[model samples]
Target chain A: MAEKKIKIIVAKPGLDGHDRGAKLLSRIFAEAGMEVVYTGLRQTPEMIVEAALQEDADVVGLSSLSGVHNYFFPKVVELLKAKKLANVLVVGGGIIPLEDIPELKKAGIAEIFGPGTSTEVIVDFIRSNVKAK
Target chain B: MFDVKELEKIKAGKKKWSEGTLAKTLSKAPEKKAKTTWSGIPVETLYTPAENAGLDYESKLGYPGEYPYTRGVQPNMFRGRFWTMRQYAGFGSAKETNARYRYLLGQGQTGLSVAFHLPTQAGYDSDHPLSMGEVGKVGAAIDHIGDMRILFDQIPLDKVTTSMTVNAAATALLGMYLSVAEEQGAKYDQLGGTIQNDVLKEIICRGQYIYPPKPTMRLTVDLIEFCQKYVPRWNSISISGYHIRESGSTAAQEMAFTIADGIAYAEACAARGIPVDSFAPRLSFFFNAFTDVLEEVAKFRAARRVWAKIMKDRFKAKDPRSMMLRYHVQTGGVTLTAQQPLNNIVRVALQTFATALGGHQSLHTNSYDEALCLPTQGAVTVALRTQQIIAEESGACVTVDPLAGSYYIEYLTDKIEAEIEDYIKKIDAMGGTLTAIEQGYIQKEIQNSAYLFQKSIDSGERAYVGVNKYTMEEPPVTDLLRVDMKVGEEKAKELKEWRAKRDNAAWKKSLDKLREVSKTDTNVMPTVIEAVKAGATVGEVCDVWRDVFGQYRPKEFIS
Candidate 1:
């Protein structure tokens, strides 16, 4: 039998309308042969967690550009943990400052990608760090 | 513009030179890569009179302030006065933003452009669940008339023109602004500013839309009709291409999509029985000034010519003012990079210069550190000074359409105009922009362009200076503006208190009136102003809209 494909959910949380990066990565992840599900703009943290559970996502990538990552990113992670999704890898990207990255990681984000990061680097990070389902 | 015999002689000379000297040089050095504009229009090795062979000077490139305003809208241009120097700034609480506004005005900035927080832009109060972590982050948090009062505190609304970058809640924001003006004893006729009330681009690129396209358009027309009757000096809608370009569209696509949107607005207004010339004059545009100086200049000129022709030929607008395409430009923010933060200053300077050459009526220069965080006061000051230096010292603004009649600029202007015409034709055939957006055609076109651009940068086909070309090992940037996390809690507490103190009976009556008026075809602007006056929060007014017209849920175009 063929190996199960990596299921990734690219989610946009909060009220940010800048989705050029989010939508671009969604296409890149799919082209990289992963099963990608993009939750459209203005998704609440709860809605994002529910989408992950329903999609059985092995990876949840959060994108926020309006500077709301500090609240929503970790909230999604905590919700996943409450649902016993501790093994699912969660990552974040957007206009996140370097100082805020360590706290986000401490809250269980596997990695945080800043601006000018290449798609190859992000895809490689996901492939290497995602826990097998 | 040249005579037939003169043009023939020049064409022959150019052919001979290209066949001999150009061919020999090409055989030796063999050009680096295919040359094209940012929009992929082919750039020739040399342009001459032949490039503008049958160009009619009168019709194609008319005098400034005339029909087919290819040169400019103002006859004297900057000789009358320099373009208004506006900076988009807001952060933290309303009082904090008010202080920043005062500081900017003190720095000699000519106009004020308000940037609202995402919660306010999306029609949510600071206390709403969706507003967590977002209040006072991107811009000032304005919930009710009280916050709006604090926002414009000492700044006299009558003396200074203010542009509010509000879309989904444009009505509420404009209502609050007008109410604050009333308190300041400013007459309605004296108010001069713009609101980015264009909602089609919100659906296409920005994604801050509240209702479906149909009802959102109704709200847009309602504001236009209201302003036409009462607020004659206010620009009702700033039909925008800036966000579309930031979302990664080519230059031609930006012009085409924006002009198409303008067409849709005029059509909607005409359908509402408002005369075409009545509201068309107040219709202004907002565009992005990218780093490509020549292409941007050409795009601006071509956009003016195209809009003039459309207003005259298609809309049958008779007033000369209705045909003018006055615009405001903001330096491209997507061009900034977090790698080498200071380089963005130079980029903004170049874009500002291009905007000047493009004959923009007003401009905003982005700060260097915006790629990392909100601009610090120091960075924003440098941005404003860059414009001042260019305006006072650069000598680029001394003449009207300084680059007009240049072989290359004229060629590119004609080419871009043709391209815009082609795209607008296609959109019209597809049952107009509204239907095209409903079918996801415009969204997919932009996405494809965005994907191709990223791929080029990733493949090293394009050199992005510090990002793709230059190698840099730099320390992490730490001196960035940080919005206090306590802002959300403070604003929520203030909203609760304000609600408790206000007369509930008046508030309920105002909201009920707004809901009733919104249901029918009556204009909602007067009722919206009354609701805000009665202490209705931004979220409360929008919730009535949400209950009436329903919220928009965009389909994910990416499979």
Candidate 2:
């Protein structure tokens, strides 16, 4: 039986222009036989959510490096919920402090990967946490 | 190099030593790691003069302070004076950043580098919807001359050298800065500072570009022209490879792409009928001093040699200063690890050694807490003190080109230079950097290198200390600095008040004049200065330019 490939939308939100992580992840996801939609730099929360819904992504990784992660990450989650994207798994990374992880996960982020996280862990997390429904 | 007889003797001795000594050691314990560096350049067990046999020392590496400067740019180098310690800083409001600048200056920081918030860098007002959550996060928020004045208030502009980390809106920022200097009663000719006005790299890696390549190149060239005439002491454009490296380019790619961009800028200015010698002297470069100590040292030396040849032989520049490649180095930001946070301090210290040994004219060391948040005052102080300790305690300042005449260093220097030249040749054949970028050649190359680098790290081919090996459990870092969200609202309120109180008639007249200059071959600085002095906001002035020169949409590349 053929299974559906995992589709992920990697978007860099807010005004921070550091896209090394997002671009690398997008490439790695594609190389891992998944569909990756990359929203270029300076994407607003609304734009990110729109892209996620339009791409029919099972996982949306929001990368925010600026210290505004607390404001931007939650807004993305809220917008995702408002759009009835409850089935999509949301992940956050890039300069988010360890203390903020619990609150972010509570706010509907499925996983929060801090720096030095191996790509294998992220890949496995996506494979398991992303709902196949 | 050794004489023929001595070379023969040394070669015979080396062959015997490798067979007996190296074979015995390898038999006991084979090499575990791959024989390559992080950049994928192969490494030899040992380098010797045999590897540097064909190197033309006199032509490739002339005297220190001579053309084709490979050893050092200046005659005495660090023996005469230490490199300027420029700390890159900015966060919160203008008033807050102003205080930080003064504090750094008081602690013996020699230069000021301003990091603008995202909105400012992207040419948006603090109140713009696109800037809602990002007004003053990464850097300070400056809306107009009012904030610019506050940012430099009480600090003597002429006595202190400043560097603004701006690109898209650099024209307005430079205008605001010059107005500040005028208000300080200092002549424009005596101002010492740098504005990172190079937009080509923004289009390539950084996403702060405001206009298409043609108009953006015009703006970059206009600054070069205007600074050559008025702001004689200022570096108009800092040709940047730092961001390219931060985007995961190899050291050779960093050198070649940066030099290629400089070539494009020079060619643009030439097409505008400006003499090369008129502006080339003020042209400075910004580079990344990564953790590869020997590679970095060789890269710096190779850059000077390459740029000198480009100016003298290619551009036919007559001035000696035009051929001299002066540069500022910043330690790599991406190399810092969030795990085992204290391990970063050692990484930074070692990287700082690379910058000092690479003969950087100025340097900025990354703070330890940057991998977590904006560096706090204590972290920034430690960052600055790292440079200071290297200058005072370390034996770095005692000699010039201290690592000269090393077998490995010379060999690597030659190798990196050849590879960089190869890339430059490829770029040149494709009709220079702008054409190459538009065709997605450079970006794809960089993206491929980045992917290879990431794969190597993931596959354990390249080992990061606390990341893949030496694992440990540590708690979250709590002492990191956080910018209060009130900075954005406060700045918006201040901008509203400033606009409401300003003379609307004069502001419009100045902006109208700015709009007029945007459509012609006339210089943009005078009108930009007039508009900024007339209370035009940063966004307002940039909006005028945006109306005339269309905004740039980046080209996408997949590798």
Candidate 3:
């Protein structure tokens, strides 16, 4: 039998229009042989959670360049927990300041990738951390 | 372990090599002879006078401010007046950004560049549920005329040239700008500025596009026609390659793709019974100044030459103004690194110099701390100072087209021009930018380049300073601009009650007109302006357009 592939949902929360980093990450995930579904730019937290649940994703890779993570990611985590999908890995990236990394991690962001992060690191992190239900 | 059979076969084949021949001499030439530069141009072992054989002055490279404008746009560029020193600033409420704009203007900035927040760029009001957390996060939040009024409250509309980096809601923003100017009692003819209203690039590079390509093209044509008739001094659209480059495109791709989009806009205007010469002269471009100094300079030279040729030959543009390619340059934002952030200062300084050498009409240098968070006041000042130091001290602007007549640059320029022409022909084969975008061809090309770049960095072929090579321990960032959390709440509250206060009847009337014109072949600018004057918010105007021209659902790309 074939080994199960990790399912990743790469989404842009809130209204951040910049998507170079998110799109790049999607390609990286796809090339790593993972099933990657890219929720296009400007997706809200509820829409992201809905997509995550429907896609049955094992990892949610959220990228925000708009600096709205303080309001966006926390809501996403709360909704995911309410929906009983807390085990799913939630990775974040973009122009995130180092200071907020701990707060985001506490709020259930499994890993944070800032600018200049290598695609290999993200792919490897997903492969290693995204657990099969 | 050694491949003795292959060695024996090679030795046998080289029978002419006598016993006197050394083992090294018996080996074949190196597999990788030439090096592939960042821009993908292959550098040969040596270049001589023969390389300059076909290229000639007055033909291939005319004088600055002349046809096939390879040298530069103005006859006395910078010598007459230096390029516009514009800084891209916008964040939090319109009032906040307005204060920043006033500060920048006071600091001797020659031009104004507005960077709208994501909600405004996406044609949504700050009160929209989708815009909840994002208001004022990336750039300034502008919901209606009230916000716009605050944006330019103290600034003189007639004196300064403003460039608003907006696309999806460009018509709405432009309408608001006109309304704001009118409210300030300034004549429409006296206003000058640029709207980065290029929608095609939105589909190709950035994903901030609202409507589908057809409606977006219509909007682009509408702006061009309106500018020609009323705001004759304003550039209708800034066909941007900056986002394309920031999205990981090569230098040649940036030039070719942006010019192709420009051609598409010109053609769209022609389809609307607007003459090419009438609207083409008002078209401007926005480009990114990347790390490769010589390559960036060559890219600009080739870009001007290629655009002039396209205007004259493809579109048959008659007026000289129509043939000139004027553009503003911003240093590549992606080049700034968060690690050893101060290094970005040097990167931006070099890139800014490249912009100067490339004959940019205006320039914005990225701040050192931008890779981390929004630039603080001191950081923005340093960013502005970088440009000032270059203009006042570097002496780069003492002459026009300073890099002109250099043998290598000319050769590289010729090569890049040829390569880009080949790309344009390919795009033409795909039925221009619209069809290419619809087919996801441009998106795929950019993604492929991005992937390859990532792979290069992964395999250690490409090195980024302070990232892949130089080791460093970063000091904690002491000064970073943290946005007030209340800004979003304030934006939401302001937009909510402002809607309650507007004249509903007039808003409905103008919106109805906009809806009717949006469905018809009429230029939508006048209708949009009427709507804005009637206090129909940007979100409402966009809703009408959205109702007429349905929202675009991006086609899926399977890697």
Candidate 4:
């Protein structure tokens, strides 16, 4: 039998509009043999979680550059946990400061990627951390 | 140009030198990897008079302040006065941003450029759910005229020019600004500044758009017409390519798309029956000064020349000011690195030098620590000092267009101009910029460029100093400016209280008038100003627009 492909949903939550990273990463993820779904700009946390649920995503990657990640990132994690999909890995990126990463991880985000992070590093992180279906 | 015999002699001598001295040098140390500019323009080994044999000095590059202003728009560039040192700043509450403004002005900054928060830019009130985490983050949150008043408190409107970087809701923001100016006892004609009121770029590069192209274009044109009549000194639209470049377009693409956008705006105004010369003079441009010094300088010069021709030949603009392309330059933000944060200071200095050499009307330098978070006071001061050093001490600003006569510079300028013209023709063929954007042509081109840029860095074809090479491990960056998380709740409560205490009946009546005006062919700025004065919030006025013109849902073009 063929190996199950990891389904990843990349979303831009809140009002931030810097989507160059998200768009590029979606393509990179697809090239790495993952099924990638990109939810366009200005998505609410509810909408992001709903995308994850509908796509049966094993991992959700969130991108926010307008500094609203603290509220929106945690809310998505909470909604996913509440929906009993806690095993799914969650990763976030964008101009996120180091001081805020601890709280974000404590809120159930698996990892946080800051600026200058390579696509290979992110792809590797998702491959290793994604939960089994 | 040289005479025919002289050109032939030089060309033959160059061939002989290439076979003799150049061949000898190549035999020992072969030329390094083939070089191309950031825009993919090939760099030659050497340039000589043969390269510019057909150059016409009179038409292509005239004297400063003359037609086809390739040298500059002003006769005495930087000798009369330096470019305005405007730092784009705002965050947290209006009071906080107001204090920052005062601090910058006290530090010898010449102008104020306000950066509104994302929610405010998208026409959302502070209390709205979509605005929950975004209030007062990227910029100050202005819910209504009350916040606008605080934002300019004690800063005399006539003393310092203010450039507000607000779009999508530009009409409401400009209305609030004009209302505040009135409160300051400043006449409309005395006000001087710019509004980055370019909405076409929002649909192409930035994602802060609220309405679709048609209605958004209406709002953009309305502001232009209103400013032409009332605010004569204010630049109505700052057609920008800074965001386009930051989104990873080549320098040639940036120049092409920006001028294309300017063409679209001029066409729109003419379609509205406004005289071309009357409004074209107030149209300004904003560009990004990237790290490629010579290429950026060439891009700016070529853009000026192209705009001058487009105005004089295409639009038949008679006024000399109408043909001039006045612009502001901000150093590239995407060049900053989070790894070796201090290196960004040097990058900013180089970009600043390029802007000064390129002849800009104003400039904004990014803080060294911006790649990590909002700049601290110390970081911002350093950025301002970088500009001051380049202006006062660098000795680069003494001559207007100092690099104008260089063979390489002139050749690059002509080549870049031709490339820009080609792109403009293609866009024109595809039914202009509006249709090109709707068909996702512009966006796809930018995305492909952005992707190629990333791939170059990823594959080590491009060497980013601290990122891909000379690697280092450093401790976490601290003392960066952090916007308080409570800024949202506080501003939301303030908005709720202000809404409750305001004259609700008056506000509703003014909004009704605005709605009625928006439906008709009449200009919407007059009623917008009235609505803000009557205590109508930004979100409320935009809600009327959303109700009438509808919101824009962009079709996802990227896979």
The best candidate by DockQ is 2
Count of backbone collisions within predicted model 4 = 0
**How accurate locally, in lDDT, is each candidate?**
0.93, 0.88, 0.86, 0.92
Q: lDDT (0-100) at residue B172 of candidate 4? A: 97
Model 3, B1-559: lDDT tens digits are 1155654555554453433353445365443344666866787544433455567677888899999889888998889988889999999988889999999999999899998888889998877887787788788988888889999998989899999999988999999999999888899999999999899998886888899888888887788788899999999899999999888889999998898898888888888898888898899999999888989999999999999999999899999889999999999998899999989999999999888889889999999999899888888899899999999899899998888777778888998999889989999998888888888887788777877887777776778888878858776576679888788788877777887888899988989888888888888998898898878877889999889999987875534
Provide TM-scores for the models: 0.99, 0.98, 0.94, 0.98
Local accuracy of candidate 1 as per-residue lDDT tens digits, B362-459 = 99999999988999999999999999998988878899999999999999999999999999999999999999898888888888888988998898
Q: Which residues of candidate 4, in runs, are more than 4 Å off?
A: none
Error of 1 at B28 (Å): 1.6
True contacts kept of 1: 0.75
Query: Each candidate's iRMS in angstroms?
Result: 1.2, 1.1, 1.6, 1.0
The digit string of per-residue lDDT tens for model 1 on A1-133 reads 7868999999999989898999999999999999999998988988988999999999999998888888999999999999988888999999989889999999999999988888999999999999986
Query: What TM-score does each model's chain B reach against the true chain B?
Result: 0.99, 0.98, 0.93, 0.99
For model 4 chain B, the run of ten residues with the poorest summed lDDT: B31-40
Clashing pairs in 4: none
Query: Candidate 2 i-RMS (Å)?
Result: 1.1
Across residues B1-559, which tens digit of lDDT does each residue of candidate 4 receive?
6788998999999999999999999999997677888767899888888898878899899899999999999998999999999999999999999999999999999999999999889999989988988989999999999999999999999889999998889999999999999989999999999999999999898898999999999999999999999999999999999999988889989999999999999999999999999999999999999898999999999999999999999999999999999999999999999989999999999999999999999999999998899889999999999999999999888989999989989999999999999999999999999999999998888888988888888888778889998879888898878888899889988988999999989999999998898999999999999999999999999999999999999987784
TM-score of chain A of each: 0.97, 0.96, 0.96, 0.97
Report the interface RMSD that candidate 3 achieves against the true structure, in angstroms: 1.6
Clashes of 1: 0
